[model samples]
Target chain A: MALKLPFLQVDVFTNTPFKGNPVAVINCMNIDESLLSDKQLQAIANWTNLSETTFLFKPTTDGCDYKLRIFTPMCELPFAGHPTIGSCKAFLQFTGQKTAKSLKQECKSGIVNLTISSEGKISFKAPRADIEEIPQDVINEYRKILQIDCVAAPKLLDVGPIWVVYLTSDAESCYNANPDFAQMAIINNKYGHGGIILAGKKPGSSQDYEMRAFVPADGVQEDPVCGSGSIALIRYLQDLHNFTETTEVNITQGGRLTRQGEIFCQIKGNADGAFSYISGGNATIVIEGSINI
Target chain B: MALKLPFLQVDVFTNTPFKGNPVAVINCMNIDESLLSDKQLQAIANWTNLSETTFLFKPTTDGCDYKLRIFTPMCELPFAGHPTIGSCKAFLQFTGQKTAKSLKQECKSGIVNLTISSEGKISFKAPRADIEEIPQDVINEYRKILQIDCVAAPKLLDVGPIWVVYLTSDAESCYNANPDFAQMAIINNKYGHGGIILAGKKPGSSQDYEMRAFVPADGVQEDPVCGSGSIALIRYLQDLHNFTETTEVNITQGGRLTRQGEIFCQIKGNADGAFSYISGGNATIVIEGSINI
Candidate 1:
């Protein structure tokens, strides 16, 4: 007899189908972990061929509702934003845990908390982050690749996953620019970061800013919508531009890639001290079924 | 209630589940053609995010058993080899048509006849092709990109799909070569061909020849097992190297990428006149389920 593994294909960062990044979520709580080897997990991820596929298991650690294992087509990730949101939605819906006010997820990064509302809105407390300076020559190389004149001093920020943040005054420039991906991949590999996130304030919309992430090193030229990138960008803004402790901003990303994803962000506390960034978005379950594999 | 569509995930060109290229096949014969718009088809293909997804429908053309439509994550392809094999296997198994000796498929590329054996071996006759001389400057560019010393006078072969064929004496060199993809993409775009195919005779294995295809412009760096490429290569050898009409050889590809797919090829008739090249391989059905798309 074939084993029926419950699966969900969720589109994250947007409520609409085919408009956001899609992640395959599998519930492996009932199965023995030893049965599914690392090679099998990698093969499942490769079958999906998506940016990431997540497997959910019962938490083995305290203070966590569930454990999440994220895998890209090529390798596994400590944690990823969209997969987090997608997996959370699938878990809540599948286990009938949506009534809970909040949930804790234990991943390779560590324990992360998410707050849920009555209306199904989910927001995550950004993981602890660190900031570092990037090399000037590398910054020049990025400027050339992104086809931008200048940027507000690129910074290497680590929020679970590392990202090189490039702040620009004009978001349209980043949205419209077609960077040399081949060259960008070289730079990304050299910097040893996830990718470069270019951010700027939105022109007229209620959304505070727009951002785009280019991750050529990962073979993804441009990320459609990046939850982790958004959180780190806000942290960078708080430190460089001195954002208020109670600041709330809406971010629009994936415009260049036609995904046009929206992420709601809220920051609490000052940059001089510890701060928590909350990133929230809607996800649509595009596919639901039992996968024999 | 959600409508469940019969679906199959098949690994093409190899019998192993995870080794060869995987394509998702959906049987849409029961569904109304008007109900499934082009946008919906593209959306479904995008959701799968595979190299190719195929939809099977009843043939509108006479003498054709079925009609197949192929789509990549980015766009639809008029013709593709792996998808053809994958779709055929799925259709035959799902429709209980396996007892048939042969099958005819109608697609955007025209009618394709496939011969199936009692042992489940499937072979396709190579399409008509025309060979032309390649430019000297382009040959030099290919030599630089392939990191090769020299190649037999390059030939531009139009076998349904146009391919720039490079005949090198060193099969190992072609198998191990890692050309600069960024530059190769530029060269492919400049040449306006499907991709460059490098072919040479393997040393020890009965699989007399080894080949590799680089299709950077199509965003696929290397094709795991290219049926059409193998056909064109045999044609080139028959004319250039004076191979006999009954010459049959087995070929391996995608070694650098670790796919290592095998393809058997046989050429009939002379290059001065009409010829038929038969390409055959094994396919394994990896996943079967009803997908609600």
Candidate 2:
């Protein structure tokens, strides 16, 4: 006998279908007796071939509505931003929970709070990032590999996933700049970094900046649109630009890949110091079906 | 209004689910108007993120039962072996064509004939390959990059997709061999080849050989199991071993990736000279659903 499980393919970071990063969402909440093992989950993720696949389960802890497990094609993640937002939308649609304005999700990284806006957008407060300055020599090596003129010193941001970030001179440079991914992978592996992000200001454009992320270590030469990478960029701005007041920032990524992935970010300053929030419009369920195992 | 299309995710080259290369098959035969443009098909393939995605349509030419279009995440392919077999299984299952023993498929590469065995395995006669010997210097460079001892001279086999192939000392070497994919990509791009294959004899094992394929140029560091690569290996054996009689060869790939992908090859010698056929067991449909566009 085959066990049929509900599955969804959701495009995240953009409401328009096929314009943003896609995540596979498997609803395991209905399966009461047989929970899928880690190996089975990994295999399903691998089969989907998506950057991330998330499994939704009934919450085990108090005050949480659901529990989520995120997995990439290669490995499982403690938490991932796009998967969180995408899976939340999928859960709501699957269970017809349209009236819920907010929800708590329990995962390996702890509980994450999500707020649904009047426009149906989803926002999650980013985990506090630990910052580290890149050494001058390493920065020089990166400059050589990326072949770009940096406007500011580079930094490493660890917000669950580590990103080595660079602020380039302008948006055109971000569009034109191509780095040696093999060398970048070597450096990432050497420093145990998750990926690298290049961002440049686009003052005149609709978006505040243009961002490109390369994660060769993760077997993705270029991520179409990266949610965690966007959060890391926000942290970099807060650290360098002195974001003392509540401010909203708009970012556009995946331009070179011919994808328009829009990310909305907010920085809030309070007595507890500055915090970042990553928000995106509603996810579009491109494929809705079931998988048999 | 959204248009809903049938979609199936099929695992090819193996009867067991999640043990072989997976292809996404979209059935477009029912759509009578507003045919999907190349851009839309490409977008769906990119969204799937699978190594290959195929669309099935009504036959455009006479004597053809169905038309197929194959696309990778990045680009379209004129022909691909796994997608052919996988899509055939999907089309049959979708249309409930249980009594058919053979079928003709029309594609950009022209017509291909597929035969179904009594046991339900699918086999396709491989296109004739044009072989070229590798230069000694280039072979040395590849030796350095792959860090393996070759038992025979390397060759480039072009059977629709070009494969730079090598015969290694033994099966263990094939399992242990790791090449610099970046360098391999550079070489492949320079030579305009599709990918590289490494095969080693496993005389005592159930299979005749173990094969590993690396296609960094195609953005795949390692293909779990490659159907075209298996055909190229059979061609190499025929060229070297003078296989004048009909012979069956069994190959196992994806062992290092913890997947067991078995390929069955047959070499037939006749008045028209030697020809190769690639066959595999029935494909397993892992996911069946509908996609809205």
lDDT of each: 0.80, 0.85
Output the TM-score of candidate 2: 0.95
A86-152: candidate 2 lDDT, tens digit per residue: 9999999899988889999999989998989888888887755678999999899889989988999
lDDT of 2 at A257: 75
Q: Tell me the spans in candidate 2 whose CA falls farther than 4 Å from its real position.
A: A32-34, A205-207, A270-276, B32-34, B205-207, B270-276
Residues B1-293 of candidate 2 have per-residue lDDT tens digits of 45789989888888887888899998999985357889888887887789999999999899998999999878999888889999999999899988888999898888888888887788777755678998998888889889988999999999888998998988889989989988898888987888889999996763399899999888888999888898888888888888778878788898877678988877777778746555555678888998877
TM-score of chain A of each: 0.94, 0.96
Candidate 2 lDDT at A124 equals: 85
Candidate 1 regions exceeding 4 Å error are: A1-4, A93-100, A135-138, A149-151, A205-207, A269-273, A290-293, B1-4, B149-151, B204-207, B241-243, B269-273, B290-293
Judge the docking of candidate 2 as incorrect, acceptable, medium or high.
medium
Which number leads on TM-score? 2
Instruction: Give the Cα error of residue A230 in candidate 2, in Å.
Output: 1.5
Task: State in Å the error of residue A236, model 2.
Answer: 1.6
TM-score between predicted and true chain B, model 2: 0.95
